[model samples]
Target: MINNSKILLVYTGGTIGMIKDFETGALRPFNFDELLQSIPELKLLDHEIETVSFENPIDSSNMNPEYYLKIAEIIEESYETYDGFVILHGSDTMSYSSSALSFMFENLNKPIIFTGSQLPIGDLRTDAKENLITSIQLAGLKKNGKNVLSEVGLYFEYKLYRANRTTKINAEHFQAFSSLNYPALAESGVHLDINEAMIKKANRRKKLIVHKELDNNIMVLKLFPGINENIINQLISAKGLKGIVLETYGSGNACNEDWFINLLDKAIKNGILIVNVTQCIGGSVVMGHYATSTRLEEIGVISGKDITTESAVAKMMYLLPKELSSKVFKTIFETSLRGEML
Candidate 1:
């Protein structure tokens, strides 16, 4: 058992690490080594800190599965040395990246908290410092001599949420993230009060497992009222498409037309996994609750049960390579692998 908490800060680039040029007033990358220098308050935190940076930090729009593997490998390599980890990432794809990491590691016994700011750390009223500082505090949290957060989480705007349950909901607001279907695991108040009951405690008896095989041959098809068969067929039959996150109508409803059902059924029979997620930000996909969605349930569509689009993509990428049978794939997709869904 580790007695002391040590945190490793992983920087993967984002607005949090950017600074505006005094002359041109344009944003540019700042040296991550200066992180502590920028936030001297970090020296006041309880835990010892170490930092690492990617060779090249790209914008979150450039984030992909390869980067996800690199992040996972870094944590795996330092797993034993560090008590917990905090990843500084771009808020644009933070949810997707964080959610992917949640699935990559099984039986994680420490906090891997992801945080970033809507404004640059150098800004007058930036959210970066507080987010980073408090995330470290949460990472170092222990109870009865055991780690508190033994799961991946996204900490932003004073709330720490299950990573897989988060979504980047706003671009201009300091509160850019939201975990609608789930309660926050911890909230940073004057006292840093944690929701003890909401934390996911891991069984330390189990060894950590890292999964690297993420297959990205999947697509998300958002349903619209007038979506035509031609576009549906084109999307379903895309070359090398292995799975589809069908963003269905409310309550998992879809067009009751024969062509739509036939198109999806044929795709399913062709070894394609189709998972149903509601387009709404809130609410679960209760397929048979409505008459329009009954055929979706009958046709073997897997319910996503209120998972965010980012998480559904991450889950698909992680699970597509396992080559589970179509039935097994459906069963597992409906089940919550991480705390991604209800």
Candidate 2:
């Protein structure tokens, strides 16, 4: 392996790599050959840089586990040669993609930083340059002759957050992502400020294990005040469903109805793993905290703690293939396989 720091820039197509078509007033993908030509400042960083562009870039909305696996494949294939990776992605599903990657790469020891712009790079006032440049700097960052930020992260609006902890909170703002329950891994200002104390330091001794078996045979059941039995029963009875992310109210609270409880209880007994995640953004799921949630707890609904819905779905997809027993599955789901929850 090469000793010097080498950062691989992977462009899978996003607003950050687009240029405007003045004639049509539309955005177009910029070529990889023009990457360095567009950003000469990259030459100033004290690290070797390489670029890899997908044949046809995907919009973030079109993102799925297949693409997630493809990203994991890219990182695995280049893991030895590159010191770190910077993924250019669209903001719309950036959190979902980043979260999936976090679970996909086990024992990761290099930064896989995802970043993109709300505005196209060709725009005069674009945020793409700043986000991309700083992300590269972060990917190349080292301390005591070892990599810094050895985990999946999303860098936007000057903050680098744990990938699984983030959620896309807005569409029109430069600061589009938020990790409410987790502090940023790093912040960029006049200088890079990595909160070393909170960093999930890598156990470099273990080999990286890339998991590609993702099962999307799951559904998200978000509860509201007037949600009825017809809707709940139909979903709980999904023909091939393997799991359900029950987006409950505060502290994993759900409706206190006999029919709802019966539907969920039957689903769990029939091998559907139900994970009870709070719909609120910033709190943990205290399963039996109130009478409303107590029924869910008694019915063996898995508590998602403080895990975000994005991460919850990713976790279910990643873990369900193991086919652990009902009790074992619930135990593992409550545990922090990745640092996705408290």
Candidate 3:
């Protein structure tokens, strides 16, 4: 129990933020007051907890760049006042939202833990209470006068992972997310065990710089065995398109057809940055590793390394508005900014 630490809970709507009305059995948004009442254990935690929520709670499917900006604004405005932040978001898009925020904040020196539950908070066997409680506890964690976690993390079913390194893999299980490429930062059991060696320590010497400009003029094109050429042609021609996350096959291989290569080549020449990320959930994109992928590397395709598609999309959105040159963007995209990649 960290005493005197202030933890801010930002509820941007999710099953975790819903409580069933006992009388009518209808789910309604749980206000901060009712939140305390529903989970009395929150009161037992020694930290000073404050909460803010979206006026109109929305499902995770409705999450977008605009909402990402809104969430960042909330944290930016209160960054100096709070010790840490725990965002209660829908698990469906938690990885994306968390990844986007990881890039939005530069040089963050405080915990930003994103968490939500598969079941509503009001359910009898809900996992919400534990998720919410432990997230707050993690957010308030401190060691030798410094915050324990300084990067964006996603905590669920007792495991804490770097936010951008995560993906929601299950729909019905309590453990709905997984970070296959990276190890868990912490695990909750009899004791909250944190992997100090794995944590991303913040550079406190630098002040936090929040980046609010995000361009969503990007699309993710997942390649399959028989993905049509016309589909590729139309997608590249999307108006004002700035980037594309090409979800390639094993080790970033894609269709070897000349038409496929030419279409992408044209897009790159027209100033669209295409990043080659592995479609497989748990591996790195090593472009040029295979004969099929050799041309992708030769044609200026940026390798996403081991980044998750969610993070790749978030990274693309974050970088698109920066107006970096094709070469510089490739260098930066391939490099790790927030521990999002290897």
Candidate 4:
């Protein structure tokens, strides 16, 4: 006997939560309590929908670790009661928020799908309706009487991707995100086609654990022509800075200049962790592959492999506060813990 699944809809603020004011012709947040009134198609699904929204909605730019903790707390409080979760978020930084949540929840066994739209739900041609309707349907899918998607993921533009692997690529296009080094977990057309082989399998016996503590003392350094030592020193020398995401050239190459090496070396000696992530969108960072990168390898820079910037940031936040030794940090950063890297 198949029982109807209960899905929790968490609206964390985005175009999907907005509506156009008739007189002002401007967009404003909609009351999700009236969800069925706006998208009645939801009533046709075979699942029960419950909603929770932020007391005061926040834009994607304002999203932070505090919000991530709040979201995790909600899921933790209702974990056993719900079969799955669907998060409505702003598109601009949805990838970052989703990536952070991926790390926050360990040993997850239920689907937590994050999605949003490029246009407000109230718009006549809004993408929100289809996105919301499909996301709910995806959340309720089951295999062998258990939730089908057992990991964190992002559903957008007709494709579902591993949340930690995705990066938003456009602001104007309806198809706004891409998983550079990974394939879509599912696709929606006339019928939803799930790539079962690509879905992550969870450990059924391990209890879900939510990690709320995240360290925000991290920086991102991008290498470019004419970037002076003074600028580098200013950023690397900041007070209490603990981690850095170094966006290097192709294959993780960077200027082999003495001053640059000296600066990085000094930071490493002071216990600051530096991760070498490639600036290229579609390739992995292969440290020591070339003479130029061998110097970075010598100074304890950890290669991020094929991890995206969003995942790198989230990983640093999750790992930095654990007080792991520099050696341990290097090992963990290089090791693919959640399928975020190659």
Candidate 5:
């Protein structure tokens, strides 16, 4: 065991940090000082564990790019001091935050594992203890004297997935997240098993560059039967809109109507980036596979391939502030910048 490894546990507010008050039966936030008391098993782990929490813990639904930048700055400031980071975030928007972090950092050489539970940590059958403990263990994993994981990851329900490839599938279930288009990077059962071939290798020679600026002037538009032009036009013409994640039908098929095509074309022509991702939980967007999607490809709509909407949004936000030209942006978005797409 690598007992010498040091890990920073960042509690950014979620069910994992909540404890039920025995007297009132009301849930209240617990200080990290008592973390050892609640989860005594953590003391058994060989690695050194330290914790930090947000001044005002927030619900995951309230998460935004500003908080995303805050998380990145925390890791950036302590990048060299700690071997790894374990973030306790709300499961609802965990994927979004994790995906955003994945793109905000370049040449990352340590694991940034995000985790949270469906139930409060004080609940009798809560999954918080297991999730918290295993995440720390994974973060501290070392091979050849180097960190085993070099990319952002989310660990839950005995599985660790590439953060950008994951989505919250169920709110009520203990197993809340899924990476439909990607495989688990690691799985826990009787033994800790890691898929060595699936991990993203980092360029350790390069210095880590943390990007602070993120543009959130984006929105997701889902296509459905009987969708009209009025709504679409309003969104496209909305002031300050920079990008759109169009959740199209199977395999990125859209309405294909002249009105639909013209609206999207106008958006792209006006410098708005449109990313075509599928509404299905699993499957890649193969533009031009169908006649409906063909026009989208011809109109300069970037194919999201197998990337999730969560990732597409984060990638868009990360890329927008760079001020890349339309041509450069299209090429980079289509390309797998962080192993987000095939």
Candidate 6:
């Protein structure tokens, strides 16, 4: 058994940290330092708990890379002091932030669990208390004197998912996130049934390396019926656009029209990396599957097989502007990094 495990609770603004005013019936930020007062059950946990918050809590819609860096800095500053971290963030962009964090921390050896609730924590029927309580439990979990969850994860409702593979699927339901291409690492029911085989094993000997350089000069071009050249051109011609995520039809197919191919080819020739991903909810992007997709493969478009949009964006942001050649970029994007793509 591990001794003296410390879990840091980073509150970056979300419904999970809000309390409803009795008089006005409005939600406001609760004092995270007073966590025990709000959730007395936290005292039952087996580890020391600490709290940190953003100076000015912004909604998740306003979340950006700067805030991401701030989180990384906090983790870096307390890396040796804490065994794990639980981040409270808004559900709307939780997946995006989690995905970004997965790429930011290389070779992580501790849990960085992101969680939030659909309702404010102060509400009687709110799901925040359970999520917060379980997240803390998961963060402090250990086996053989080491941390159990050593990678970035999202724990919600009853499932714990790899951060990069998750997406927020519900606005009104308690289970707001889903992992489309992966299995849950752990499930909370009568007990925390951990899928030990599914959990990512970390190399504890490796020192933590934080990657802060992210290239954001990229655009997502989603294909739709009757999409004209003008619309395509506008997206491709965006200033300083260095990469494009071509959200294609089934099996990575798009309009076989020469106009479309020419536009894509020109973008490729101009040194803009184009990646083809399926728009379907649950299928791999299989380039060259049909005549519709053959042109994309022939024109040097890379396939992002079985990767979700959130992972694709995070991968691109982490990869682009690096010293990689076009050929190398395609190879890496198609290859599985951190099990984001199968």
Q: Quick one: best lDDT, which candidate?
A: 5
Q: Across residues 230-267, which tens digit of lDDT does each residue of candidate 6 receive?
A: 98988898889999988998889999899999999999
What TM-score fits each model? 0.97, 0.97, 0.98, 0.98, 0.98, 0.97
Compared with the true structure, model 4 gives a TM-score of 0.98
Q: Candidate 3 at 188: error in angstroms?
A: 0.1
| lDDT tens readout by residue for model 2, 49-152 | 88898878988889888889888899999999998999999898888889999999999999999999999988888999899988999998887789977999
CA RMSD for every model? 1.7, 1.9, 1.1, 1.2, 0.9, 1.3
Off by over 4 Å in 5: 1-3
- The Cα RMSD in angstroms, rounded to one decimal, for candidate 4 relative to the true structure is 1.2
lDDT string for model 3 (114-214, tens) is: 99998888889999999999999999898877898998999999999999999999999999999999999999999999999999988999989999999
lDDT by residue (tens digit), candidate 4, 2-106: 336899999999888999997999988899888887788888887899999999889999999999999999999999999999999999999899999999999
Tens-place lDDT per residue, model 5, 19-59, is 99989999999789778877889888878899989999999
Residue range with the least summed lDDT across 10 consecutive positions in model 1: 1-10
Worst 10 contiguous positions by lDDT, candidate 3: 30-39
Steric clash pairs (candidate 3): none
Steric clash count of candidate 4: 0
> Candidate 1, which segments miss by more than 4 Å at Cα?
1-4
Residue-level lDDT of model 1, residues 1-342, one tens digit each, is 233579999989999878878789898887777777777888777578888988888799999999999999999999999889999999999999999999999989989999999888878888888998988888877777878789999999999999999888899998999888999998888777678798787888999999999999999999888999999899889999999998987788889899999999999989888889988887889989998888988888888988988899999999889889988888888888887987
CA deviation > 4 Å runs, candidate 6: 1-4
Q: After superposition, how far is residue 317 of candidate 4 from its true place, in Å?
A: 0.2
Q: What is the lDDT of residue 302 in candidate 4?
A: 95
